[model samples]
Structures are given as C-alpha cells and as structure tokens.
Target: MIDVLVAGGGPAGLAAAVHARLAGLTAVVVEPRTAPVDKACGEGVMPGGVASLRALGVEPAGRELRGIRYVDGVRRAEAPFRDRPGLGVRRTTLHRALHERALGLGVRIVPGKVGEVRQTRDSVTAAGITARWLIAADGLHSPVRRRLGLELPGGPRGRYGLRRHYRLAPWTDFVEVHWSGQGEAYVTPVADGLVGVAVLSRVRRGYDEHLDGFPAL
Candidate 1:
C-alpha cells in the first residue's frame, strides 16, 4: 500500500508531495489532467512562496518579476505592504516546477480524476485505489474532502480575478497591482516575451465588464 495518495496536482498538492517524498514517504499524486495544465492566477510568486520553494529546491520555470508593487486594490490604498516581499511568476511555471520537483523526489503522480474514496480502519481506497493514508489537495472545492465528509467552503465574497498575457516588454521589475472600486488587478512578467495581468473584484461580473475602464489592461 502507498503511504500517501494525494488527490490534486495544484501548487498545494505539488508542494505537499515534494515534502512528503523528502520525508521518505511512499507518496502518489492523482492529477486529472494530462499535461500543460493551467490555473487562473496572477502568477505572482510572493517572496514567502519563493522561499518555501527554495527550501524544497524547486527551480522556477518562469521569469521572476524582481520587485513588488501594491495597487490600491479594488478598495484599499496604493501604498506598499512594506512588511514583506512578493514574487511574481506565472501559475503554469509554478506548476511545472513543482511537478518536476515532486517526481525527482520519487513521488508517484497518478494522472487521472479520482472517482471515489473508501476508508477503513487501516487503509483508504480512492476509487478502488488503496493507500495507507490519503491527502485531499484538490482545489478549493475538493471532492476527496467531500467524500471523506469534510466541508470546504468559499471565503467571504473575494475579488473576482481574470488574467491575460501580452508580448511586450515588462513595464517594471515590480509587479503592479491596480485598484478600482470594484476590485484589484495585478500585472507580472513571465517567460516567452509575455506579461501576465489579472483583474479581481468582490462581485462576480461578466468577463470584459471593466476592460474599458482600465487603460493598462
């Protein structure tokens, strides 16, 4: 039986698998997607996130936006947090880096959607796949957690976020987060002559609803 079976391949799951293998656990990750999977994020790797990744020996695959800038946000002031440093990288890059790191450390990645998980006193079977223990690192809405009878709910209406890539050079080494009354938008530079920009709002609105208002977007 496997020591641990992870139910997702996202950042959290990837991180957990890397750490788990380093700890000498026979771990496996069940990812539903084949490859070139993506996430809808501004792709900014906060300094803290980078430090943690470095500790795990994860080499980043995307360009790093060397500095951090704070946009007033959809509701806050434009001043910097000053308390900490943030790294801006793409979500896909982060995923790829973590994916490799996990594999190098000997984590088995099962690339398929988990159907069900049955638990007994000594072992847990995920859709007939058995393991000594199971970790549900799926997305915010984790099916594994649901199957195990745990409740995962959304946080109080958070900003709605959207992102796009551009082929121009970056405006600054720092990631620029822009704020409007509706929400916040973030900009980051990634590899391949592209820049990643994200728009966030507390209320859910149609895509391109505020595109005209933001000239930079």
Candidate 2:
C-alpha cells in the first residue's frame, strides 16, 4: 500500500508527491495525461512559488522576471519586486521538471483516470489502489471532490482566460499587463525567444479581437 495517493499529475499533485516522499512516505500519482502536459496559464511563478519549488529541488528553465508593469493606452505603472525575481516558465516545462524530480525520488506515477474512490477509517482507495491518505488535486472540477460531496456551488459568470505563445524575443524583463476596455492581456517571457500572452475577459471574443486593441504588443 502507498502512503499517499494523488489524484492528479498537475503541479499540485506532483508537488504533493514530492513533499510526501521528502517526508519519508511512499506516494503514487494517478493521472490520465502523460508527462509535459500543457495548459493555459499565466506562466509566471511568483517569487514565493519559486522558492517553494527550489525547496523541492526542482527548478525549471525559464526567463527571469524582474517586476510587473501595467499599462493602458494613456497611463502606465510599474512595480519592482522587493525580494527575488519571479520566473516565467511554460506549463509544459514546469510539469516535465516536476515529473522528473518525482520519478527520481521514487514516486510512482500511474497512467489512468480515477473512476471511483472509496475510503475507510484507516485508508483510501482510488482507481483500485489503496493508500493511507488521498489528495484530490484534480483541478477546479475535481471528480474526487464531487464524489466526496465537497464541491461548492458555482459562482457567478467569471472571466475567461486564453493563452498563446509567440516566437519573439522579450522586449522587457517585466510581465506587462495591458488593460483594454474589454479585457486585460498578460505578456510573459517564458523562454529566450518565446513569449506567452494570456488574455482575461468576461466578454467572449477571439484572440485577434483582443490583440487588435494593443497594437504595440
């Protein structure tokens, strides 16, 4: 039996497995997707998150971000980090790094979706695997949480986030946030010649429609 069973292979699940191993526990992670998974995210790891990653001895390659900058068509503002600079890493890169570290530490990764979960007073079983404890880091719509009747009610319509990568050298060391009338665009440099742009908006529109307002981007 495993000491811990993680129900996802995302950052949170992998991190939990690493921490469990560090604490002298045998952990297994069940995920449907393979390694180096990609997802839409801001791609900016805050200074504290970076430190936490370093603590686990897992450092992914990426660009160093010095600060954050906000700009509208007329006004601009910038703030430098008081402590360590943040890291702008792609989601795939981060996942691969964490996956490698977890494997090196002897964390078993099973490839399969968790269909059902059962728990007793002493152990929890998921996907036919039993463990002393189970961590449900499956995501926003976690199946495990839903099965356990732990899901909360849905909130109001929230802003949608869309991200895309461009093969262009970064113009600045800071994450640039451009605010338009409809949405906000976050530009982050994830690699030497690659930048990731994510737009968050309540209005439904294509990426081109959002970028049309920020011609300088």
Candidate 3:
C-alpha cells in the first residue's frame, strides 16, 4: 500500500509528489511518457510561479524579463505591475529539471499509464496499485477527472487556442505579449538568442494562420 498514487507526471503531479515526500509520505507517480516530452506552452514562468519553484529547490530556467508590455488588439503598453521580472525558460528544460529533482527526492517514477482506477472506503486503487490518495495531475484532458465526474471552468466563449513552435534565439529581457484583432501572441525566451512563440485566438482557425505574417520570429 502507498500513501499516495499520483496519475500523470507534469509539473503539478511532480510538485505534489515532491511535497508529499517532504511531508513524510510514500508517493508514486504513474506516467507513460519520459522526460522532455514536447508541449505547447509559453515556456515562461511568472514571477510568483518562479517563487513557487524556489520553494521546491528548483531554479529558474532562463534569465528574467522585465519589459513586459501588453497590447490591446493593436498597440502595446506596459502592464501595471510592481515586480522585478518574469523567468523565461524552455518547456523541456523545466521538465528535465523537475524530473531530476523529483528523482533526487526519492520519488518513485513508474513508466505506466493509469489504465483504470477505483475507490473504496479510505482508499483508491489505480489499476492494480492501491493507495490512500489519488491525484489527477495529468493535463487539461485528465481521465481521472472525467472518471470522478469533476468539471473545470472553461475560458470565455469567443476564445480559442493555437500553439506552435519555431527555431529562434532567446532574446529580449521581457516577454512580449502582442494583442491583435486576429488573435493574441505570447513570446518567451528559451535560450540565449532563441525564443518560443505561442498564438492564442478567440477564433478556432488553422494553425498556419500566421506562418507568413510574423517576419521577425
């Protein structure tokens, strides 16, 4: 029997297991994929998010960016915030670091997907492994949540998302979020002279909508 059986191995799951172990509990994470799994994310951690990482003994992935400017469908303006800067990191870099940290803390990483899970009085059984608690940190489309009949709030009605990556350098001291009538663009620094740009829109259209528009990136 285990104290906790965590489904999924993303940031949330890894964080939970690490904390659980620090609090003196037997934790195990069931995940199918290994480290460095590709994802569609901004690759930048907000100031507060970075602070959370520090609590877990993890460092920021890239240099901090301060010149954050938000645009309103056309022009841009500095966001009203009283903070130093946000940390820009690559998705793979952060994932690898956290995976390593979790392993260092005596976390059991099982390379198996949670095919099934059941609950009983004071216990939960995921597949054949039983534990006192079950955590569903898989991702947006979490199977555990669906099995447990949990619902998460959705975004606005007219909002949609489209994320793709490109090969670029990690430049700029701050992430640049461009607001446009077509959609919203988020840029984060991944490495020296390399950047990761993501696109989010209120309309669900083809991903190549801006493949020819963005010249600099």
Candidate 4:
C-alpha cells in the first residue's frame, strides 16, 4: 500500500504529497478536477509561505510583493516584510507549480474523488485505493469528512469571497487592502500585466455590489 493517500489535488494535498516524498514515503493524490485547478482567492503568498515553497524546490513565476498596504478612505498604512519578500501569484500558477513539484518527486496523481472512506487501526481505504494513512485535504466541505462521520455541524453564515483578474499593470509592489463598512477588497499583482481583485463580505450580494463597498479600489 502507498504510504499516503491524499484526497485532493489542490495546493494542500500536493504539498502533503511533496513532503511525503521528501521523507521517502510513497504518496498518491486523488483529485476529480483537472490539473492546474483555479480558485477564488487573494493569490498572495506571504514570506513564510514563499520560504516553505523554496525549501520544497517549487518556484513559480509572478510578481514580488514587498509589503502590505491598507486603505480606509483617505487613511492608508503600509508594512514591509522584515526579511523576505512575498509572492503575488495566480491560483492556477501556484497550483501548477505545486503539482509539478509533487510529480517531480515521484508522487502519483489520479483523477478521482475520495468517497465513502473506510478506516481501521492500521490503514484507510477509499475510492478503490488503500493506503497506510489517508489525508482529507479535499476542501472545506469535504465529502470524506462527512462519510467518515468527522464533519462538524454547520456554523453561522460567514464571509464569502469573490475574485477576478484584470489585464493591467500593477500600480505597486505591495498587496493593497481596501476597507469599507460592508466588506473588504484585496488587490494583488499576480503577473507582469495582470492584477487580481478579491472581495470578502458577510452580506449576500452580487460581486458588483461587493465591489461597490471599495470604491477607492
């Protein structure tokens, strides 16, 4: 049996597989989505995360961020990273880097979802595969967690996020966060001529409605 069976192909799962291989353990990742999966996120990798990725021999091409900037109407604040610069990368670019790193380390990836996991004292089984250990990195609403009765009760409605990309040059080398009463918006430079904007709010509304909260963006 494989030493590890990762139930996702996202960054988390792929990172787990990479770590497993780095430790001389065999790992297999199961994911239903295609390679280089994309997701709605701010797409900014902090300095520590950048260090960790470098340690794992994964370097993605993107803009370098020197610090974070916060904006509230006319008020603005900036904080630079003390040691190392962060990375502003697209989600798909980050995923592809991690996926390629995992593959280079001999981690096998299969296109499938983990469902109805069966576990015992010694091993775990799911999706017609068995491993010495199973990692449930599927997502926030993991089906394996529910099938194994490990899911917790739903919490109150919280913030939702939406992200979009603009084909324009970034104005600064720092990630900018715009704040308002309703929600917040994050602006990051993901590429040479690409910028990503992500909005987060607890209120249920359209993306345009959420963007309206951060008019200064």
lDDT of each: 0.74, 0.92, 0.77, 0.91
| 1-217: candidate 3 lDDT, tens digit per residue | 9998889998889889988888899999998998866676777787887888888888846867666766554556876336656787877778888888889989999998886778899999985789999999987778788778786678224455566555665556677787655776788776676777788776667767753344344
Higher lDDT: candidate 1 or 2?
2
What C-alpha lDDT does candidate 1 achieve relative to the native structure?
A: 0.74
- Compose the digit string of candidate 4's lDDT tens values, residues 103-191: 99899999888878777899999988989999999887777777778877772445788999999999999999999998889999999
| Model 2 Cα lDDT, one tens digit per residue, 1-217 | 8899999999999999999999999999999998888876889998999999999999999999999999998789999988899999999999999999999999999999787888899999889899999999898778788888986888244677888999999999999999988889999999999999999888888888888878777
Worst 10 residues of 1 by lDDT: 72-81
Estimate the lDDT of model 3: 0.77
Model 3 lDDT-worst window of ten: 208-217
Clashing pairs in 4: none
Better structure of 1 and 3 per lDDT: 3
Query: RMSD for each model, in Å, please?
Result: 3.2, 1.7, 2.9, 1.7
Relative to the unseen true structure, what is the C-alpha lDDT of residue 22 in candidate 2, on a scale of 0 to 100? Answer: 98
Enumerate residue pairs that collide in model 3.
65-173, 168-194, 169-193, 169-194, 169-195, 170-193, 170-194
Report the C-alpha lDDT of model 1 over 30-59, residue by residue, as the tens digit: 887864477568887767777799899986
In candidate 4, residue 176 scores what lDDT? 98
